[model samples]
Target: MSKMDKKRMKYAAKPGLMAALDIGSSKIACLIAQPFEDGTIEVVGVGHQVSKGMRSGNIVDMTALELGVSATIEAAEQLAKENVRDVVLCTAGGAPESKLIAFDVAIAGHEIGDGDLRRALDPTWLYARQNEDRRIIQTLPVGFSINGTPVRDPRRLYGEKLGVNMHVITQASSAVRNLESCAARCQLDIESHVVAPYAAGLATLVEDEKNLGCICIDMGGGTTSIAVFKEGEVIYTAVIPLGGNHVTNDIARGLSTPVSHAERMKTLYGGCFVTGSDSHETIKVPLIGEDDSEENQVPRATLADIIRSRIDEIFEMIAQNIKDSGVDPNIGRVVLTGGASQLAGVRRCAADILARQVRRGRPAALRGLPEAATGPSFSAAVGLLHYALAERQQTSFTSLYSKEMPSSRFGRIGQWLRDNI
Candidate 1:
């Protein structure tokens, strides 16, 4: 064989590599991993950078965001000693919305098959077309029924009708396009796009929590994303525009300190609840735009009060959003993951407000994962890696419907039958 051809063969024999980029309001993280035969992943490289030109998970400065993304990707590639062309990305912006869509196809007493499942799911394409301004990012089949009787796997079941309840997640087209544009500038092709909260839940929630019912809340710098899981699938997802940054801003304004100092103070001394020691403990707050020698001594209780008010407000909104989602707020425990979840007393405050069992969540340990990256701040990024791998094992109806379908309606049906039968 030619030398170039021999090199290609050698490279092809190696296991494929996967990369995931988590773009958040406050930070950007990249991970590169290789999957093993034992259903585990070994992370080879990791990189993170302070986010720029992004606000509330939306790109506001394309050039700045592009630079940040490129740097982060380069750092990861350098560490792994491998370059990747494609990456799976997760987003917390774009005003993501979720709806449960029911679709059915007439079976006429025939046994349900893959073609029948495809037919049942085809209508979601029409639904997407009807909503021109939004793009469907995820389509999860929560359940299937044959002739109105639910079945775990409808294939091969005899029924006159086959139906599916699809949990469809969509984001504004502008938001999705902006993200795509930024990634394109970074010379990266998006393998898939996942919602931030869904990715967080996948990384942090245990199997029982997902199978029973659980809420995963990922608190980032500028947005708090939420995912509700039931029956081992994500049934609902949401993003709130308030996050850790808001708390920092509150501290800055209340203490008249620079944003940097305010963030430091919140990280070191802030708490959602005040203790008796708070009255005795004091923090030195530097006045904004002032010399280091000019500062005010403030009791810890003052900082705690400011942090408590904002944290309480956030949890209250979370509580109300859960109630509005129509899911049983009491159904399962709550898992809190993300940077803001690490603050003192946040978990207890969430439990008190939501009236559910709440626990701080971190990503599952992976091979070669660094100690610093094991915290809640990195949960979404780690979850993106998990989602990218798991996604390959499952079929994405949305992809088939939107990208792979034939132009002609009859041609689509024929192709589906040809593939399935």
Candidate 2:
């Protein structure tokens, strides 16, 4: 092989460094980590800042967005003392769509082998690429069957017919292109883009919850996304363009205050559930363009009431969306993650509306994380690290096809010659 090819292979084989860039509506965060021999990821660097030039998780201004991304990555690089050119990105934009496609083929009453399996999974990208405006992001083989009997691995199994069920996720092309454009302007290459909620599910859901069934809600600043996992695979995805920002807007309108003051109020005194003491407790709201002496005071109960109403509507819409997709919200437990899910009383509110036990999900603890950074807000970034590790271990098509061949180079050359010549 040429020197360049050898260099590329060496880089690909190394598993020491991994980076995840989480771009959300409210904030942009970058994490750099290294996977050790003990199956642990040690964080080396982190960078986070207020997000700009984004709305509803989509890039609205390319120049401004590129600057934000550049700044975030530069900060992370400074801490790590190492520069990175590529990153694993997390996306909640593009109105992600998920569906299941089934493939079946005849095996001629023979034992299933790699050839048969390949045929059964043939044309994988072709089918998903039928739509010109959509691009496939994830393609997972959820189940396999031999002779109409479901089996996890059909290799060496006897069967007349083999079938496979694949769960595919697709997103709008325009959204993806915009992200790529911004990355290009920032001098970064995107290695992969995983859906925001799907990544959160990977970081938080336990084995039992994944096998049985579960719902993951990722609440962000500009969008609220939902992901459903059954039998340890993602089966459905949905996104709503309303999130914490909407609640802040509602508070501003209801209290006749500035957006900044409303946000502070929501973070400090917001709760979906009311208390008896709220009646006597009061909060001072600063009006737009007004001095401190002109601030208005109102009962805490009124603020809670406004916040609760908006939160209730969000959960109600989430429940209805699940119903519309033909999945019962009560089928499994609900896992809540992301920055907005950290609000007080949000879990209880979700439980009441979705009719399922709700638990707050946080990212797995890794070395070198500050107390302030280890929270649900970083779940997607953590999950991206996990995903990069798992994906690197998966078998490639070339290796699978050559599994039964002789190990020696000459023996492999003979086999290839016999097949081709």
Candidate 3:
């Protein structure tokens, strides 16, 4: 009978196909899934392509990005034997920002209810409204308290005051618009936007890790993203502009090799730490703009040194970010995932630099996912599917002001109050 109830019914009536699209600087990936009656989804299609016209997760060339999106989606559709018009997009660009906001509402000694919860969250909505130049990606209720005492659920509790702590994540509006435009050009509609690191965390983190507190670091091609989870919710997030591509660039410059060759070399022979065998092994690096005969022979130790310096720098930056966030340094563990995390010794390097238990994380195994796509690089893409499922089931709070809300600011606020209050 209520607006939210009607919306739920509408979605329930049409549990159609769902898709997740992850557009990164190095690659664009698409996954198509079919939901079942038992509240589970199975992957039916998977596709990915080398990305172009993207830098640090933002679109640089609309046309080129459009082509990549179209191609990736088409490939997935072909595999799925189904056409999809809407996709949950996973984004790491747009200068994502995260902050915790606390708010309280006077309950007048009455039993708390949904109305009280909404009223307590009014400050968060107001905060979102004030930032016209940014779009909210997620607004999560991290904790609740009644009369200044921490409580899990304040509903039905007798309290004069109800308080809530919310974790809000936002991104620049221009970046969101560009991504939307690119999707539109590819004849695709964005059903929702999930932050990359958050998505990765959802897919790769175990329930214990989330509830007990842990950090999920997604090192992608152009950027590295961090998400801190506590009590089964994200408490903080940060993005660093350095990633695997930076290491590749370093290798290319240090070895005087082409970017493509440098990447291949890194993938095949690079490591963050030198080994005793490194000095004895040799790798032939082809000189840029030169014949194969002019290739330079270098000790594997030299290549490892180049990679070690950059990877160390990346981990150091991550360490500094965690410290700057003011989060507990002893927080349970650190899970590292992404393309860069696949490098040999990356886990060890991360442990050494972050001084925490570090493990390479990959997306949880899906029914139809290929083994090749089960690596850390696909965590964000798979996590988008998890986000879609959570949103559909209403198990997670996607946002206070969702896409289905009224268009006008005043109208939206009024409708929200009327619905909840």
For candidate 1, the lDDT comes to: 0.81
Off by over 4 Å in 2: 1-16, 109-119, 122-128, 328-330, 395-421
RMSD of every prediction: 6.1, 8.2, 6.5
User: After superposing candidate 1, which stretches have Cα over 4 Å from the reference?
Assistant: 1-15, 395-421
Tens-place lDDT digits, model 1, residues 109-226? 9877677676677643544253446666666778888889988778788988878888877777678778877887676777777899999998999999999999999999999989
lDDT of 2 at 344: 88
Which lDDT value does model 2 have at 43?
Answer: 81
* Alpha-carbon TM-score of each model against the true structure: 0.89, 0.86, 0.89
Which window of ten consecutive residues has the lowest lDDT sum in model 3?
Answer: 412-421
lDDT of 3 by residue, 1-421 (tens): 5432232222222247889999999999999899887889999889999999888877888888887888888778777877777889987899888877787878899888666665565444444354456666666788988889999778789988777787767677678778877877676778877789999999999999999999999999999999999988889998898899999999999999999999999998888877775778889999988988899999898898898888888889989988887888889899999999989998998889999998889999888887868989999999999888877776664343344532212212221111111
TM-score of 2: 0.86
Worst 10 residues of 2 by lDDT: 408-417
Off by over 4 Å in 3: 1-15, 122-124, 399-421
Steric clashes per prediction: 0, 0, 0
lDDT of each: 0.81, 0.76, 0.81
